[model samples]
Target: MSEPGGVSTGGAIGLVAGLLALIGGPAAFGKAGAWLADRADRRRQSRADGNREWEAKLKAWEAELDERAAASLRQCEEQCAELRAVVEKMRFAMVLILPEVERFAPSSPLLQKASSLLAEILPVAIKPAPAPPERPESISA
Candidate 1:
């Protein structure tokens, strides 16, 4: 049915619907945009929290590694100190015994040569060799 103004009932309904859509479209779009922004903010905060935790763990791991390295360094220094002390004691003993060793060695040119060579080389060797037996008959030529 047409109204007196020649507008049908369906046309009047369509006009009203179009006007409502125009007015409400911007409001609905703004709400949806705000919701999306809030979601993105939440995600960003979550990532930041994860990053902070990772950083803390990395720092702790670094501290543990530093402690281990410091302990190893201290142990190595102790070992070096002990080795120095032993060396010093051996050097003192060598200083006391060297002259007697030379004097008591067999009075032969070959034996003297060997003894001097041994005295020169002993300090540098890892361990001192046992002294040769002191039998005159065994060394006599």
Candidate 2:
């Protein structure tokens, strides 16, 4: 005999199979989640390693910069000392020459001639003023 409303037992079995598949789908989803977590962990470790390497490089660069700066400062100080010595020598020579020039030139013509000779020979750059006394007011008192 046929079924009562013509629906068969095979349709019921198919519906039960579909329901089972729906219930088991979450297990597959859990595997995908675990794989993603492992990948993220590996990426985190890589980033940490990169950061450490960069930090070491930065420290080394800073040390090199400091060394170069110290060397440059030493060179500048040596140059400055040499320049000071040259200036002192120029001052001593000018002192000796200026007295002789004044002694020889009591008149305007001799003075002009001496000045012209000095300009031609020495080419003096700067004229330093004489230093004032340490305590001028006390000396006057």
Candidate 3:
């Protein structure tokens, strides 16, 4: 139908619809706001989940490093113990050899030089050797 002003009724109805959308009634604008809020919340939750996963991985890596360090420490301790035993054996040998070298000191100048070299090269802990054995000695040469 045409109105007296020469505009059709259908055109007026279209104008009213456009105005309603532009004005944005409560139902229309409210639903859009809710959707935007939901999207923001989802993004926040995703970031939080990612942060938690990263934290867990970091903790696991730290634990692995600690375990490796502990294993290395144990291996070092074992090696040190073996080295101590070898040093003790060397000291015992020096104890037995020094007396023989001293007994033959006048016969061979080479033996006297070797004895002094042994003294200089002995481990720090066994510097003086062990009093050169005792009476009867442990080994006969």
Candidate 4:
């Protein structure tokens, strides 16, 4: 039905809708702004928690890698130590026995082979391996 003064029903409904928007727009906008602010605050804390988890994982991975590297390095050092001890012993034994072999069997080919090998290898094993070069920073400028 139409209202008085020729106001159509559609016009009255449109007028009410416009009036409601005018009154309610700012309130709705403020409520939405509050909701978004709260959401952002919540997400910020969650992001921090996520980052803490990632940091802990990185620390654990680094520790594991360091442990593996240390284990391999220790193994290498043990092998080198065994090699040095064996070389020192063999050099002593060769020195003690080579002369006896030469005196007993002057023409033995074993003496020649032993002598050549000792000449090549003994000098290296006789001296302690040179100390590693000093760090570059240690030298006086």
lDDT of each candidate versus the true structure: 0.74, 0.72, 0.76, 0.78
Q: Please write out the lDDT profile of model 1 over residues 41-95, one tens digit for every residue.
A: 9999999999999999999999999999999999999999999999878766765
Number of the top TM-score candidate: 4
Lowest lDDT sum, 10 consecutive residues, model 4, at: 124-133
For residues 1-141, write the lDDT of model 2, one tens digit per residue.
Answer: 336877667876666556656777667457656877989999999999999999999999999999999999999999999999997798667656665556544455765565666566665732323444478786779
Among all windows of ten consecutive residues in candidate 1, which has the lowest summed lDDT?
Answer: 121-130
TM-scores of the candidates are: 0.58, 0.53, 0.61, 0.62
> Which portions of model 4 show Cα errors greater than 4 Å?
1-25, 124-141
Q: How accurate is candidate 2 locally (lDDT)?
A: 0.72
lDDT of 3: 0.76
List runs of model 2 lying over 4 Å from the truth: 1-31, 107-141
Across 57-92, the per-residue lDDT of candidate 3 in tens digits comes to 999999999999999999999999999999889877
Model 4 agreement with the true structure over 42-95: per-residue lDDT tens digits: 999899999999999999999999999999999999999999999899888987
Error of 2 at 91 (Å): 0.6
TM-score, candidate number 2: 0.53
Error of 1 at 41 (Å): 0.7
Q: Which of the predicted structures, 1 or 2, would earn the higher TM-score when compared with the native?
A: 1
**Cα displacement (Å) at residue 135, model 3:** 21
**Per-prediction tally of clashes:** 0, 0, 0, 0
Instruction: Name the better of 1 and 2 by lDDT.
Output: 1
Q: Using lDDT as the measure, what is the rank order of every candidate, best first? A: 4, 3, 1, 2
lDDT of 3 at 115: 62
